[model samples]
Target: MGSASLWARTRGPSQKAHTAEITSGGIWTVAPQLEQERAVTGGGYSTPVGVTRAEPEVNVPHPQVDAVARRAQERVADAIEQLKDYLAIPAISCEAEHADDVRCLATKVRDDLSAMGLQHARVLELDDALPIVAADWLGAGRDKPTVLIYGHLDLQPVAGEEWSTPPHEATVVGQRLYARGSADDMGGWVSHMVSLGAWLAETGTLPCNVRLVIEGEEEIGSPNLERFMDAYPEAFEADAMVLTDCENPSDAVPGLTVSLRGLLEVELHVRALSSDVHSGLWGGMVPDVSTSLILLLARLLDDDGRLAVGRVEVDEARRAAGADVPLTPEIIREGAHLLEGVEPLPLRGTSAAEWMWWQPAISVVATTLPTPAIKKNALRQEASATLSVRLAPDQTAEEMMAVLRSVLLTDPPGGVQVELRADGWAGEGWLYTPKGPAFEAADRAYVRAWGRPLVQVGVGGSIPFVALFGRRFGDLPLILNGVMDPLTTAHGPNESMHLGIFGKAVLANVYLLDELGALGRDGIRS
Candidate 1:
């Protein structure tokens, strides 16, 4: 399909040329040709600290970088073969039984890094936790900035029956590669490795110092990341970071993620009696735990699907940031892959994109009760459910959890006892504004590789480690880009990665590193 057709199919109808200007809150407004040139030359981009320079511009034209990247693109077949070997390992970190597989993948990654000529490549062993691979190349002097690349080596579990091809075996159909981790993350890891390998093969040294932190526990909400960070603070220090685990809005246009929603997992349990009681014997006299839990859950949302626990207000800055992003019902339908009979929720006084990316939302992830197959007619002794809440940028997990706890405990259903407990893996939301030299360099790199302006967007999902990195690095520019497109079907059946986009992403990273190196040479701080 043509790029325009694919974009329309994936992101709804196209908007006017002026609409793009409104989406960014007026931070970027220029003619098409001038905008592309400014993005390439860093002419009109602003820095947060207001530091300006008139030094000689380091210009590596698109053709020069593309030539080097084309050499790497020539090896796409080899890269795919190696990726198949990597994907063959069932590195599901959520299940304890797959711990060995996770370690195997970590060792493989470390070996690959070593083969790439990195000076230091080893796995950091955490006590009772999956191993994390940490590698660095300090060939570039301290005068140059060090760039950290972050990705995950683990993946979600797979069901064999649900997939058209074997999830663990990389199967290529047309231009797409089908595998468990092909798009969600292994594609990201491979992209980094390919770029670095290409640079090292073409030239003996990299443009800047590099460090990699590939973790094995990210699929499980990164439960051990905090412990890892606390234990070794100096290992992760870098001047800038590029997290290679996000999805593009469409196949034609690359997206740079600017924000991620925070996550809070909660479990609510209620008990009315010590044991299951006969409903017919005491149907009128005894309290129903199921009914009580149902009533409590009903209070969680009002008629409009807004959370009723407390007022959900959007941040002024975030609202402006998402103002002109076109998110029609058709767009949501295509993006979400809604079933034929499934209808979307009513408009909640905001665009669907704004509601999804900038506002708070709740979903009852799972519920536990007696199965109808067992034919149980007794009143259940206890009822429980799992609630997952996605918090906006300005909201913290603790504050939202407090509001939910207050509402649940306000009034009891006569005799039923209620208990609410957090799942111990709360993650704060993260917001980043594109400014300074690093962001501009990334924008130029994206345009150079894709021939289009990069889309600054927000992700409704949460990556716990991104927020952790922000806290640890504190204002260091974070470039969030990835290879997966809208139709990659990450974390779902028949997950695949488009080879065309994957090759382009590798080329884009090559350009990104070159651009950042030029800025470092010019004495840019970030």
Candidate 2:
């Protein structure tokens, strides 16, 4: 029987990619307000280095930005300390046991935002889900544009992962803070806090109206984020948004994520008999389901072991853009933690960025095949393997499934029964081209802080919230940035955030608000 079905689990990290979202340029969503708590206050990239250009420059540093930037620089150590406090909480959202930790972190953050003098800081609670922290400072007035800063308070679980230091204890080793959520999200938003706090301390008000929507379930793919958006839409409304949960191409090069691969998990199964049979009696007579399962899976890959189905053709412009990302095998080896001798697969004709961020890929995440502990001298009755597919940006789960079914369900070895099911996760990929003045505003801020403009980059990993944001607010400016570099190792052991990146992100944020503020409410979306 060649049947295709889906056994999707919409939430949880163990069964899905429980990661947060994207942006280097930025995104904006204008939604109707919903019921929410009140304690008000709030407010909230960039270029390459100083290559003098002939074009008239629009992103000059704001006069007040210098004061804020200086203050942020002074607060770097304190900022890292704050990050340490957040990392101490084991707020892994995927595990049920850690749900309280998630709420505890949200409560702590709500209290901190209130203490920071934001007008309204409160923890938003939804039934059957963890709490979300929402706050804002609207003192900048109605004319100034409101910039929403988004980040997650939850973390990826560190169980079974080896670490150089205690995973929950923030350890500074050579200017990098090692801890889960340090860079993946905590550092990304804390850097903003340092800048916003400095702005408040120096001027008593933000350069623009600002809103904070720190999520509690981002590490679990933000499964209920939409429900939160619908029930508390006020929490997400803004003239422009700065999504701070992406990665930098390098510590030296600030990346504005412009594209991302989506995620889809499918289980491929094969059965030759109702129950196990003695290998001595049936090895030659019956088809080995385990062997057949392996053979069928092989059909999904080219010699490179990459997913061969549902491939998309990239235009020259996209290829040229991917070429700009500074991804090398050495960087991948170091970032991905490949052993000394194990090398990255050959790039073949495509650039690493294209192969990673723009193409489909596959990994065998789980299998029901025999293990050493359960080895037996019998022909297995059935075998199954769960495949995690990274879909190309703009590719949908339905499109990928169609291609998979065509390749895997055609001819069966020994005509063994076969079935395919989407195990969990069918999150869409994101592809955005930043436009309007908000983007120019971002480039100016990045140039001032990083000494270079933001390099548009793409994320090979999937972030469901990003695609959701892209769909809900694709028309406006949404700047996606983060404090992560290749070496941060988010969702892995010894995750660290480069302090230098943290400092630069703080400075850039300081200038970004100033730049966006100058645009005015009408000017930003215009």
Candidate 3:
């Protein structure tokens, strides 16, 4: 077959080629065959290094290791099938027409959890909120540390034009798994299930007590999770919480997210006139709303792309998130896909790295305007633009919203009536210091599984529940480990999973349990 056809043909990782080598520098590199070709030819490729034992050949054939790896792969395939079934049920919380889809997905999750041999698995039913799937296995001991695993099962609505294939169908192309929720939470959630199954199949028991809480309304800003946290604090109290819904660094680096930026989405509306008037007669007399909107947005940031809000500092953010790293420029250009001939935007007089990880960003998500194709040669009287602001650490959504509103409306651009209001928000930042036995166990497991140094990083985007969970369970460390690459295009169309990393993720979780088991129950005792 031609290269194009081969690239188009979807195959599982077991069928793909691989190369394993221990470099003189002591990094054990495992390059999957599918990625090797791409890496040599400038395709996005990743080789997870130092996570496994040094080996000269790819696909180690030790019976016990091979058995465990094969079991993990099989579980991934089974979960892919399960994911396809789950995605087919469109549980769009934003749409009122698909309420049944939400329930159906909940029922499926409950059933899947039950099938995993957990002692108790049931949906946490609510009157108006989508039910949360709650499951737990205590095993034979009362002293075992109970680790709570959290993820969302619902997905955002999909549009046909936005996807290369049907977004709901789990399309396997080469070593990639493509679907709407395939990468976001569905894929991440299913990974937890499959990894648990591998542990069960290989050892006949989990490394420690496990409680799984998968929700259905996370995509809709998780308006009900805080209330749920309050009502069932007992169920949530645990040694640690494992969040698989966070972002990973670029494909090259393995990272544990230590912080996240908050979000504020606001709409600024401007009225230049009471009604549309003929441009020929009113062109010079009336101000244009579109022009005013652009000018207003421009004032939010200085020429250096830093927020101009009083007392809002972007340099501190850059320093906090480790903006002095080498991957800044490459990762930014790769992540943003800037227009051709457009240079990377500088952040506080530094490279894109400083701008991306450490700095705040203001993006115009959408603008309401009359279509020009049907233009009636009339001057627009009113217009609105939605702005998405990424707040730095230590900043509140309300504070940022107020600042944006004040800036947009405080000084009127002559001839325009302007108003600003908060449209949506995912509240502000958090920093995680992983302490106690659980964190030590996680560190050991990651090292044993991947043979690499665990790098601590900060996610620029928001995970709304991270901060909420911090307040609910004081002093308990939250472990933010995930497999979504920066270019994974999560929350967009044609999302995919890199099978190599997915397999490694399974091993990491398995080893995490093993390390925790060594800590005994009292180590995690609060």
Instruction: Using TM-score, give the best candidate's number.
Output: 2
> Alpha-carbon error at 309 in model 2, in Å?
2.2
> 1-526, model 3: which lDDT tens digit per residue?
0111101111134734344432212233454465444432223322222122222122211224334444665465456677789877877777778777888888888887787777578878667887788888777266767788888888887754477778877777776677777777776777778777776777667767888888888888788997777776666767767888866565444567676777888788989888888989878777877788778888887786666773445445335335424455566566566666766655544545444554567788899877777767887888898888887756787777777767777777884788888865467677665555566556545543444434556677777777888777757657888878766677777777655456557656765665565566787543
Ranking by TM-score: 2, 1, 3
- What tens-digit string does per-residue lDDT give for candidate 2 at 1-526? 0011101001122322111111121111222222111100000021222222223246444556555666666677777788899999999899999999998899999888888888689988889888889999998898999899999999999999999999999998877889999998999999998888999988898989999999989888898899999999998889899999999988777788888998998989899898999999888988999899999989988897766778898877678766767788889999998998998887778888888888899889989988999879999999999899999998889999999988889988889999999965687888887867888778766655665567778898988888888788777688999999999999899999987788778878987898899889989988
Give one digit per residue, the lDDT tens place, for model 1 in 138-183: 7888777889899998999995449999999899887789999998
Residue 64 alpha-carbon offset, candidate 2, angstroms: 2.3
Give the clashing residue pairs of candidate 1, or none. none
Q: What do the candidate models score in CA lDDT, each in turn?
A: 0.74, 0.80, 0.66
- Per-candidate TM-score against the hidden true structure: 0.83, 0.89, 0.81
Off by over 4 Å in 1: 1-64, 159-161, 226-235, 284-286, 304-306, 323-331, 412-415
Error of 2 at 127 (Å): 0.6
Runs with alpha carbons beyond 4 Å of true place in candidate 2: 1-56, 59-61
Using TM-score as the measure, name the better of candidate 1 and candidate 2: 2
RMSD of each: 7.5, 12.9, 7.7
